[model samples]
Target: MEVVRIGIIGLGNMGSAHAKYLIENKVKGAVLAAVCDARTERLEWAAREFGNGVARFAGIEEMYASGTIDGVIICTPHYGHPAEAVAAFKHGLHVLTEKPAGVYTKQVREMNEAAAAAGKVFGIMYNQRTQPLYKKLRDLIRQGELGEIRRINWIITLWYRSQSYYDSGGWRATWAGEGGGVLINQSPHQLDLWQWVTGMMPKRLRAFCAFGKHRDIEVENEVTAYAEYENGATGVFITSACETPGTNRLEVVGDLGRMVIENDKLTFYRLRQSETEFNRTYKGGFGEPEVWKIDIPVEGQRGQHHLITQDWVNGILHGTPLIAPGEEGLKGLTLSNAMLLSAWTDEWAELPLDEDRFYGLLRQKIEASGAAKTTEEKTLDTTGSY
Candidate 1:
């Protein structure tokens, strides 16, 4: 049981949650040694919450300079992710950063390069991958049980964010601030899952997105994308920050059978062999497909971030495998970029995506966007129709 010292660089909702979990869970041998935040009030709150023994700082440099913390969890805003993680990596500290990796792909790439150069463990918090169902699915696919995935459809319309939600943080939807809407923030998990579960990459993509009804800022609130995989399998990805009583159902159809995860419940419809055997075995109509409904038990809803963090820390200390490496963080970011780029250009964008072209587009967007402020004075309503 090797001990690892932990530090956190943000004290907002998610960051505070991670810190509290570190305190409560006693995650393996990890210790919450320090906390940092730029906001004076938040920094004071974190300092008091962590008590006198825990070091506190107003910025990342101070935290790194304090010399007590080994690894740092970066839970900052969308724009700050790359710089913070890169800094931590440069300081030779293992890093765990919240998703989207960056507001743009280039930022993530820089952080990735920094991590590679520094030879430090860089983990991204796509904790949703910790779900047992996904782990099983990954295993099943690896064993060739899925037999080459043919098509996948992910409907992530449940990410509902309101105008007041956007107003809660002035940086919510601006291209320069949060980068993009649903894709950058809420859908990164699903996008990552899309590529992870399918075990593939898109060769080309065409997307349609809508700014729709949000008066808060400029950026997409709804998106629909069609992607062609390198292996010739196709997928449709639909996401929105606007929808009432929306559905989140991920369905994948492979050569073997079809699996569906709806509202956290996983069900697999395993198809029988031949039509004659199916007709002789089944009691349904002549034209009906032969299928067996299989129910998968649900795993408990513990804190995924804590579990992922523990795994990462243990991996660093004891040579265990990482749940999600920092480099993989760029996949979701790249997917988001492709979708947005496709929508912006109203054309199909080829994959093995051109990072430089996308970076240029992002630079133009950032320069065009004037200073936008963000505040936590209000809570974003995670419910609304686009």
Candidate 2:
């Protein structure tokens, strides 16, 4: 197909935004051909806003049956992600899922298997990976400019959601609905970028998660996690609600230097020699390796969701490499799931996480969540939040 006809499921805040972008001709080589939502009001909105050119369906199956779209973008809730993607793949359609893959790894694994078997292009909306600063960081590490990584720390607590925000949706912050709180809803991109930029996944992790710590919700709002990589390097991740003025800072320490990203600025502290070699050869007992503080330049605009969507279309039509492959999304989901699992069990969770156990525990939570209580709905302007 020269141009990809894209259908978006779940016409909520994000789904609506995607529709508007496409209708406004924001993404090149892509058109909003179809849309699906169980809610009649949402379908009406789509019809009114997008006009008669866009086909509207009550469910994903009907949308697929219509055969109006060459690809599908799943923007449903946390749980519907995997199921919808698998359905799209079964119909031999390309898919681009939002993030977190799904509520749990077991289901996401099945979805990935289906995508692999279908041989269709599967992409995940890890939009932050398109940021120039993160791309630069990944390049620096991959080029061995930072030498051996020794430590990493990220304080990404800018995801402050009020109780009203949670109350706006029935599935805002529930174990059964949205999976977890901050980690699942707000920090998925950061968690994905953590592994994406570093190119490392923790071998094991211990996390302390506080449920309803800031809001009247059932999932985590505050978390402090410690991770140990296979290379013996350690890292710490701290995230929370709007407890204080949130901070977004990432620091990576290596034997030769350290890189810090904060306030939209990138700084590097380079050592004249590797700390390991200096320590081994220096005669002085108290001297340290000479350090130079240099400002790293990162250029270009951050290609957020729109960029990923365009790339997904490009990948399907022209064999372009996806910025976020659906298969690799499991790594970040594993980290998030491991954190919740560790907090729930009060123990460290190992990598290649116990899928069955996690799924079982999640099922229990779903059963226990009696009925979701929703308040007056409001879609906050999510312009600068990302």
TM-score winner: 2
> TM-scores across all candidates?
0.90, 0.95
The sequence of per-residue lDDT tens digits that candidate 1 reaches over residues 207-308 is: 999874455568788889998886778999998888877888888887667888886678878766533355677775656556788886766654378888
Clash count, predicted structure 2 = 0
Runs off by more than 4 Å, candidate 2: 372-386
What's the distance in Å from true for residue 133, model 1? 2.2
**Model 2 over residues 214-252: C-alpha lDDT tens digits?**
568888999999999989999999999857789999999
lDDT (Cα atoms) of all candidates against the true structure: 0.78, 0.85
Model 1 alpha-carbon drift over 4 Å, by segment: 212-214, 274-289, 298-303, 373-386
Worst 10 residues of 1 by lDDT: 377-386
Q: How many backbone clashes does candidate 1 have?
A: 2
Model 2 worst lDDT run, 10 consecutive residues: 376-385
Q: Candidate 2: deviation at residue 30, Å?
A: 1.2
